[model samples]
Target: MVHDQYMSLSLVNINITSYCMQFIDSLCYILVILGLVGNILGLLIFSSSRHTSKISSVYVYLATSSSIINIFCVIRYALVLHSKTRIIINNLIGHVWFACKLYELSFCFRLISSWIILFWMFERVTCVSKRLRTLFYRWNASQLKFIIPCIIIFIILGCVIGPPAYMYQPRISKNKLSNSTIKSMNYFCGLPSTVSIKWQKYFNELHLGLNHYTIRCFFSELFPAGTIIIFNSYIMYYLFRTSYQFSQINENKITKERQRTTSWMNIVLILHSCLFLSSLFSHVVGHFLSVEAHETWWVLLTVLGNCSLNFYVYCLSGKAFRKQIIHIIQRLIILISYKLQTCKQQQQNHQYDNFKIENLIYQSNHVENINQPKSYGTKNYPKTIGINSSSPISEQETSV
Candidate 1:
């Protein structure tokens, strides 16, 4: 009975594993398609526009970075989907250098994407603050070109710690009793094992303990998320305070436009904050769970959410973005309709020319018969008035 129960449990585990893999495969494909389309559209809209405000320029950079990161994520997920299952396990174990390096690259991009959001929040806070408003407003396009690259370089340098954190080594073990050999991996990123003599001696001699997951979670998830929340809260407070101040003053077109833009920014900030917070929560939960937990799904969901939400947020909140999208769509429609009409007109002209040629041919044949030798009982052509008439042909051609 115990053996049977064990077998049943094994079967259940296998079933669950199969189902999870299938789900992840489907989700990856769906995210790849949707994320690519959405991010590309966003890239086009943000990059092509001319913005007088520095804040809008900041948004353009943010959107561009997000689109790029989304593309990277799609590629990363596609690689995982296509690679061997054991390769993925080795990645999780942190023993395969190739997988570790690939993960590190993805991690760097993820950090950049997250920091971009945090920086955007900071920019908003600066814009909304009365004291900093003048300073931020004075930031011109040339300064933006310098500032954005500097920030990007800083983010890339900061995230360079990822590769070493996930370092590992491969090993093999043998079970003497079973006379079987098994492959084992050692993660240098985790706490040193007390039971293994080699690890114990290594740890005792070096006095080092590294927990990559803990460090990564704190820096990548906790710190950035907390910063975003704090800045976003300050932005909300300042926006409300500014609204009250504006209400006290006399309303004007400029004030109204400022208010509208502020409102849109606030809405976008709130939406993005909610999305990032949810993703952070999912990541934190996945970290605390067992290896067998369906954490990949959570990770995939987080990636998909982060990649796709920005476009929707912009569409819903930014009037300028919406107008641009609408304008582009209208132009496309007009262009297509014009081409279709031109084709139709061409077809009509061709048919009218054919009709004219056929009529002329018939008239010429009738005139020829009239000029030919008359057969017995064949009446002479009456000057071919109807068939050979130029007036009717001219009229037909003119009407066509």
Candidate 2:
């Protein structure tokens, strides 16, 4: 009976795998299309001239770079995912290990760029404090000195995580040889045998750093994401309570509406917090899973999924962005429709002008025929009809 139960589960797993393999290509195609559209639109709208304020500049700049980096990241995983599925996955000149290294390097660049965006947001929040902002300005001689700090932070981050990118590789697990073992392994590769044992401690350090990063993510996110929700949510509640304290304030619907909108914005910020938290968790999971037994499926899933959550957050929670997207689409539609209508009008006008020219030509010919009599047989004939001055009765109603 136990064996029969096991056989049933195995059959189910195989059926699911077959189903996933069939549609995985379509899913990838859709993902690419969506990434292209959303990222391009995100870049364009976020990086507008009107949004170049001190308040939004950081967000816009980070959003632009994130979108671009995500596009590249998608392309990288696409090859790895396809190769694992054996669906036309290209090899690095028939060498699988080289492909693994290239994929890892591309992914590292993508991830580092995203983390930099988060750090950029931290800089923005710092600038919002009046005292710190003033001090920052005084400490520097140049007007654009704020950017220098961000440049320094990115440099530090690159130094810390840049080396492990090339060192990490994906390899299939031996446990996967038995169907009763783990469902998936990490998208991990075995290190090349050419490296010496002297670098063994470095791997140990890298593993330790990976653990520390998880803890760091948890603490970093808890304050900004969790405390933020609790504090802001209550502040809004208190504001609501105060509004009802006076009838005059309550009577002002416009003020109440503004307060309501602002309150909703706080809600959105909470939603944004949740999204980032979820993504942070995904990163934590992806790290461990990829390290233990690097399954290609989970690897691509985590990377792409974590990157994609932001796009949905912006579209769903950001009222301003939603409005901007709608406005842009409306303007584009109007522009296209107006152009088409104008072209149709021009074509009709052209036909009318040609018709007028033809009428004018016909009229001119008619007028010329009357104005100049033809010299038929050299006979002198009046163009107009003449009546005889002296009329006499003739036998045949004719005159000589």
Candidate 3:
């Protein structure tokens, strides 16, 4: 009797898992396609337009990459949408597992990426200071903008890729579904099973659990995310105050640069703040909430926490990017409409020419028969219209 019930529960759980995955797959597919198109357009426009050639373009590059990371995550989600086993314990979790892990890591890295954007933009403001101006002028004058993006990319690459490869699986806590959770939930939802490992013990000699779940969040989620929030928050406050000094008339040139920097900073701040807050909320809620609630919507909140907001940043802050997006959308619309008109015009013109040709043929035939004794109608024959060919003309001739 017990074995039969166990089998039945597993069957129901598996069915729920499959349905949940299908829903996630559909959601990710839409976001991935849109994000890939949008971010690529952003990059292409920024590269061509001279508006952001200054050091700040370096920062825009970082912001662009964060969206790109989201695009990558969604693409991986697409490939594994059919997965049924929740938290499959394998020797080493590959792309599917990494995709889930990366989704969380993207949250923290987004803050880092956001900071670089604000940093680069703020540098533009600082460059106007007589003291700081020369350093940046020298930096740009020497084409050192490459260094900023390179460093940020290295940090991001290290944050996501390096840690897991070296660290191995610590401890992951798996929650057995409670009767209440199973009753309330229609799907299988698993949190990052808590595996506690003390970072201090790993780095130093202190004794702490390795399989605990919070450590992963501490190092990967909380630490990096907290650093980003604190660092950028201070920068944002200073930027706001400095921006108000724009009302002062003595330093108009500096003020303009500051305003641009401040505006971009505000955008960066808001995006990161929302992301950080959402992630924090989801993490806290998941740790405390029922398994069903965490599995169903909380995970989605966590996955989409940072990724969806990037389009907002690019659209609002980067003029070059926004213009390029507008141009591409306009170009797509034009291409669709342009061919329709061209085809319609061509058909009308073809019919008009054919009608004229027939009229001429009728009149000429009438004239030829009337003058049949002496007239050859060949000379008056309307010249055949020139034929267009893909291959080049090989011959030209007078008729034999």
Highest TM-score, which number? 1
How do the predictions measure up, each by TM-score?
0.60, 0.58, 0.51
lDDT by residue (tens digit), candidate 1, 1-400: 1111101000112232577667766676676777777777777776786741445566567667767776776666454443244344444545555644455455555566666667666665655676666665576443664487467647544544543333322322222444556543334223223346543333222111243444555555667788987887787777777876886796888778878878877887788678778767866655444342112456556756576555676467666777877887798799999999999999999999999999999999999999998677436535344534566554585566
What's the best-to-worst order under lDDT? 1, 2, 3
lDDT (Cα, tens digit) per residue for candidate 2, span 1-400: 1111101011112222576764665666666667667777777776773643445555566667777776676666555455343332322312366655564456454444455445444544444445656675677533343466457546644543444445644444333546576565333343444556644434422132433333333333333345444444554554565555543545677777666766675575566566555655554554454332222355455445545545655466446778878888898899999999999999999999999999999999999999996675535543543455343333234554
Model 3 TM-score (2 dp): 0.51
lDDT (10s digit) by residue, model 3, range 28-136: 5565666567656655665655665664655456545555555554343333332343333121232244544543344344444444444444454454345566776
Candidate 3 local lDDT, residue 221 = 48
| lDDT of the candidates, in the order given | 0.59, 0.53, 0.51
In model 2, the runs with Cα more than 4 Å from the true position are 1-17, 20-30, 52-59, 78-90, 93-101, 123-128, 138-161, 164-190, 198-251, 286-299, 315-319, 334-400
Candidate number of the best lDDT: 1
What C-alpha RMSD separates each model from the true structure? 13.4, 11.4, 14.9
Could you tell me the lDDT of residue 164 within candidate 2?
41
Candidate 1 vs candidate 2: the TM-score winner is 1
Instruction: Show the colliding residue pairs in model 1.
Output: none
